[model samples]
Target: MAEVLGAVSSIVTLLDLAGKVIEYLKSASHADDDRSRLRDEISSSVAVLMMLKARLSPTSPHVTSLQTTKTLAAPGGPLEQYKSDLQTVASKIVPSVGTGRLKVTVDKLAWPFKTTEIKALIASLNRQKTLFNLALQDDHLSISLALQGSTDALGAKIDNVTNDLDNVKQGQKGMVHIANSTDWPELTVPVQTEAQALEEKRRIEEWLSPLNFWITQDDTLRRRHKDTGGWVFDALEFRTWIDSPGNMLWCPGVAGAGKTVIA
Candidate 1:
């Protein structure tokens, strides 16, 4: 099954590489030297793809697919080479097509893709890849949740809540209330202005939302600032607040002397 699918995958991969190079050319993104290098790379990939095809089952279903293609149907094109190689391998697997489980299913099918169709498919795939990459870079896209309301109000019996709200998830891809304990999930609180949206984007990137902070190094007498993300504070100028042993805070001591310790 993989052999059959591998043949298709390799063909698509080859086309994708070609498509990307052409896109780079149109964008003027790379120099002539880069284009030369990429063309060389594509040629090398094709050679390796051919070698892999030869090693797979000669009776694989793709040979039947290749036999009817116009490009290689005659001589010297991809289909001709594929068909010839399969024949060389076929006898070892099966004496005749009737006896073989992997029998060829030849057809008079036309080229499945014209230049425009191929280009469009490749471009669409590229667009999807770009979108996912952009999503990954976005801090908001990396789902996180913090309690929107108080856990005490949630009640001791409340183990979960529906994640359809209070989650910065991407189409069912992010964590749910289950992760709200680790970091208060960043909210996409909507505002009336574009300025507010831009501010929210920056605030998310700046790590300003209330988070789980702990003292690390346990021995610095000066606790090192640490967050759930494992990012460490390297500067010591503000280490006094963390060093004071009495700085055990639920929040940042923002309102007043809410909680204190007696030594």
Candidate 2:
């Protein structure tokens, strides 16, 4: 149970770190090359972390849902790939910035920081990567213990652990929601404005309701087509004409030739 809680904590910590990195990326300005590469790395790390959280979830039905047939695995199937991606980003940034020199304040990095500050950011990112890897390792060990029947002695304690993990996930989700609402006002504001816009659109639609009256009903025509042998419509010439890119296909005939039904 303690191990489970610890793993959850580690995953949340990694998410928090990744969020900070993403926030920094959003606010900071850099050369196009550096900006694109850094953004890609950060986005990839966040995506992998999210998938890792889902895969590690104790309550997730998909955690143990393996198929017997050959199938494409989820992108972040092996933990090594996630770790390697993060490590690659870390290594790219760490050479220029020595470790342990930068202080990380929660959600409070001044935009457009100096070189030293950027170094600090990189150092923080590396620390997050290391911690994330360690957490994944701990989770793997926990699963091993479970598989080996070590957790059998815990019995009902397993349920408690699952409940605790769920609570933790809920708390993390709430925190993320709060962070997003606080950090990105645009998200919250647009929702209300969009609702208002939709309401206005509904009113306009109501006002235009009478316009629908001008449209003629085609149900009678449809019924006539159904009464007749519909196979005539599927004839090669008819199909060829329909498939052609020309804007109009005119079927000229005498009045009783069922032109209206075909049309």
Which candidate ranks first by lDDT, i.e. highest? Answer: 2
Q: Write the per-residue lDDT of candidate 2 for residues 1-263, one digit (tens) a residue.
A: 34344444555665665565555555444444454455665665566456546645678533311210001122332233334444444433332323865443323433343455445445544444433332333333323233233445444454555465556556666766786868575543222244554565456445433223222224223325344747757777778887887756566653224443454
Q: Which lDDT value does model 2 have at 5?
A: 45
TM-score of each: 0.19, 0.28
lDDT of 1 by residue, 1-263 (tens): 44345454544554444444443333332234543443344344345444334333356321322211222223343433433333322222222346655243322212222445335433433332232222122111111111122334333223222232223333323344335445556643332344644555555534432332232112121212334212223435335557777675332331111111110
How far residue 89's Cα lies from its native spot in candidate 1, in Å, is: 36
Worst 10 residues of 2 by lDDT: 64-73
Steric clash pairs (candidate 2) = none
lDDT of 2 at 229: 43
Instruction: Give per-candidate clash totals.
Output: 4, 0
Q: State each model's C-alpha RMSD to the native.
A: 23.6, 28.6
Model 1 error, position 172 (Å): 50
Q: How does model 1 fare in lDDT?
A: 0.33
